[model samples]
Target: MALKILVTAKRVEDPESKIRVRPDGAGIVTEGVNYKLNPFDEIAVEEALRLKERHGGEVVVVSIGVDKSQTELRAALAMGADRAILVRHDGPLDPAVVSAMLQKIVEAEKPDLVLMGKQSIDDDQNQAGQYLAERLRWPQATFASKEASLESEAEQKKDPGVVLGADGRSLTVVREVDGGVETLVLALPAVVTTDLRLNKPRFASLPGIMKAKKKPLQELAAAALGVDLAPKVVVKRLSEPPARKGGVKVADVEELWKKLHEEAKAL
Candidate 1:
């Protein structure tokens, strides 16, 4: 049987371009900002695609968001996932709620390999992948930076570096650690979230975009998944940072020193 890989993606407001800020010291309103896929998730998708190429398998991209997320899902398909799945919603939910939704997706997919970005840039919670793994009772390797062989060196001396399981369960992954990389030879059906170092994401060409339309996309409601989409926490309001004022230029070194000692307090 071919290997199965599940990758999680997210559509987030692009922080690169400026967005409108609230006048009342509230957080920047994201209601109208242009959005893009989380960069780390893109790298995870790229790694999943590469693994499929190397070992021969199917890559399924999953995303949890409102209807606007379909654009991001389609983008994943255009990049080369065999299919896409969307856990649709209307607005932001707490990360824990999102993780609950993802647990349902994991139950449905039952993939040998589960992958996701380290964290979404928007929230930066970095908890979904780990939470999903815990919910599914699967071993997780987070911050994977490279593809790894799922075999021992002694075992690889005879056959391919990759090992096979009697029940079709085995995996090898390279993850990042405190000082450097840690290569983990683990059993299959594992959750592995990727970091930015995993791989460079690809651009979707026009032809690829056309091809993506043919790929299968399955949609599921959060309610249908038997999970409460209600948030455990709430964002009461948001605020923008205070604007900066121009600085005065000193006339000479002595003046600069005086200004530093008196006003700037550098002394």
Candidate 2:
């Protein structure tokens, strides 16, 4: 059967170094924060597109964010997604709650494969994808840095027979593990979150961008999904990390080694 893949993308501010504390200390208003697709999510999208190209299937890119997220969705379309969906919302949400919202989408789409980033840059909670899988009761494989193979019982009657790579069609996954490398392959109808080491995401060319405008984008409101937007976890406060002091450059290896062993506490 052809692949039905649902890949998620997110919009976040570009990486920055400036940090200015707010008057209330509730959050830091970083300067010159430009929005872009989350890096890990871009990898996830690239993985989905590669699989679609190799396996012969459609790739659908999805996102949950405010109206500004459309730009990221368009980028996904330009990168080769057959279609895109934007689930728009206004406020910040806990990962668990976001998972509920995704569950509704997965139920409606009934995709064979779902992909997402390992974590969002803004919160770094990394709980949304796993929670979505749990809610749907589908198999889940997190932090996948490589391609995933799929098989079905329906394939057993075929000529060559289906040879799935270990994880079965239920929840097998091949992912990155510590100490050099290891892969975990899981079953079908599963979720696979990605890491930075995955394939580089593509940029939309001018022609691709123009074509993307003609592509269809289905918008679904969070309330329509029967989910309460209220968050269960409340953030009582937010604060910035302590500032790092400028370090003096050592003139020689001896001084560098001395600094590393003594003041740096490496020794």
Best by lDDT: 1
Regions of model 2 farther than 4 Å from truth? 16-21, 147-172, 260-265
- Candidate 1 lowest-lDDT run of ten: 154-163
Query: What local lDDT does model 2 show for residue 2?
Result: 62
Q: Could you give me the TM-score of model 1 versus the true structure?
A: 0.81
Tens digits of per-residue lDDT, candidate 2, 161-258, equal 11234333543345677764555555687888887655556677888888888889988887788987888777777776776888798899999999
Give the Cα lDDT of each candidate.
Answer: 0.78, 0.76
Give the per-residue lDDT digits (tens) of candidate 1, residues 1-267.
477989988998786857666776345676668898888888878777766765678999999888888888888999989999998787665778887888777777788888899999887889888988888788888887654333444323322223335455666666779988787766778888888656667788899899999999999887788887778777777665576888898899999999999998988
Error of 2 at 129 (Å): 1.3
Clashes of each: 5, 16
